[model samples]
Target: MNQPETNPDAPLPRPSTFPDGLRVQVQGFDDQQAADGLGEQLTALFVQMGRYFDIQRLDGVTIAIDYEEALRSLDRGCATRELAPSRGRTVGVAMTPSVLRDGVLKSHVFVDAAVFFGMLKEDRYERAMQLLAHECAHVEVNAHYDRCFPDTLLRTKYMNAQQGARSEVILASWDEYAACALSAKRGENPEADYRETFLNDLADARERGNECIKAYRLHSQVGQIVREIREIYGGLMKHAAYYLGNAAGFGKSWRDDPAVAEALTEHWFLPFFERLETALAALYAELGVWPNHDGFEVIGDIGEDLMCEGGMYFYDSPDHPGEVGVQLPLTPDTVPY
Candidate 1:
């Protein structure tokens, strides 16, 4: 295994180890009491997670809770760093990109306190723990995955922004499914909620697409070189991927429900949803098996399948030379003012 690069200039946080060998590093808290309180709770929560999963693998891992620092670090790594925070959000992150601290390759679990504490303020403790468990499961799965297969997809450099964005969505879909499946054994099963969320997103995307079409027909106006329809459709695709993956992770019985089946079919995303769910289950089942496989490659293939089967195709934009345009699964009719 290649050793993680050392950054000597990085500031070190004071990490505390609990009785179970779980180490947590808390930062960006003004009140020491609050910091200690959160640390103790996190340690306890990790211990609880150990009951179902082999969390012992995370012994040397450092769980970092820093809102501001996490935001800065994640933004630095993102392509849309110049864009406002409302464009995207990061609540937690995990795994094999270990940091070298004091000559030791230490894996990490990062949770943004801004999000976690906000959930707690709303008395959403179960949801917060579910998020934490999902991150921790990412650490566990990533470690095991590294030992098995070489992740060729994410590690490779993409040629363009669109390619990079597509890869990001695929990778995120696979990661969320694996982590959510593993964590849901001990956490909450949110399949019903996820199903509703996806349907709602589909409705909103279609509405936005309608407005974009109306604007283009009347004034020959669009959001940018890329049409607003494509942007909203792309976002809708990602939302479907994430929610369907999460729903499948907990349980797939929802798929058989009359309402969900009808809604998915009507929205024209059922094919993609089915393909993704099938691929996710296959990849997850192959984990820890004898022969190693590149699960990321499988996901990439699934993405191709979805694009072909779900009516998502790309063409050169007629209005903007050298620009790629997407054809969505559902066509939006122009709406009147």
Candidate 2:
């Protein structure tokens, strides 16, 4: 009998067993084998990133996917980054991309049915992996901002901005824009470029007479934010949903999922970004952060609300009273951990 070929690129024996700092807590699924495979894939992805980015502390995160309630959460309205803690130690402190110290520091992600099913669909698994990568990118971003600011309110403003006092919406959206640029997983797994995939899908849509996704790079940070500010989602969101659904074969039961992505693209994204840029200019004008700008430099030593101190990263203002702010966290964390 012929022997199956072996992969030369398979990782060498590591010091630890499975699930180092990064872990998985799946709920509402009865399919153990499939879930285990999913968990293993996610764990390997994290491990690969840990070594590639040199993030020793990458193990401090847990990602949960509750297939059942995920769609329910979307039905009612929900936010991404739904499974994280609320403190400095909880947010994590992976000192660099290459080294993440493992410990009590925590961050997490919650994937729902729409994305879960999409990931399982043939030819779409790697595309969904990029979305997961976006969420993973969020872990470090959270660690950077949450630990950078000792005060909850300051971190709140940095993350949520016009978003409500509890919303960490902006950071999530920003990272989403940052994470999907690569063709596939950077360190280990090889897959198609997400941008290329989207373009090919867009071409497929165009051939089918759909044009909502616009033949531009919707995969970039500035592109997403700028488009949303222009109220692009108002018109394009539904069409995009149709395209996304058709591409994934998700059908009508998952119709709203893409709309939710579209809605979030508009609401949570714009305010924080608008305010952050304004605040950055103010900080530079005041010269608080010269060259070495850690994410926390804007927050000051003791969690001073930068907006009130002649700064503006949110709509509420003592200087400009009665101005509107971003929408609040409209939904609860579906898989609170």
Each prediction's TM-score against the native?
A: 0.64, 0.39
lDDT of each: 0.54, 0.34
* Tens-place lDDT digits, model 1, residues 1-337: 1112438797533232223655465667788787777676667666655555544445343334544445445322213332112233222333323333343223456665666677678877667667767766766665555456443422456554345545655556766667667777444565666566567766655455565554555565433413354345445555565565565565655557676677776455565566666767777777656274455556555554444343344666688766665544333331221
Clashes of each: 0, 16
- Mind giving the per-residue lDDT tens digits that candidate 2 earns over 62-149? 2335433432332111222232222321122111121212323334345554444554564465555545554555454444443543
- Cα lDDT of candidate 2 equals 0.34
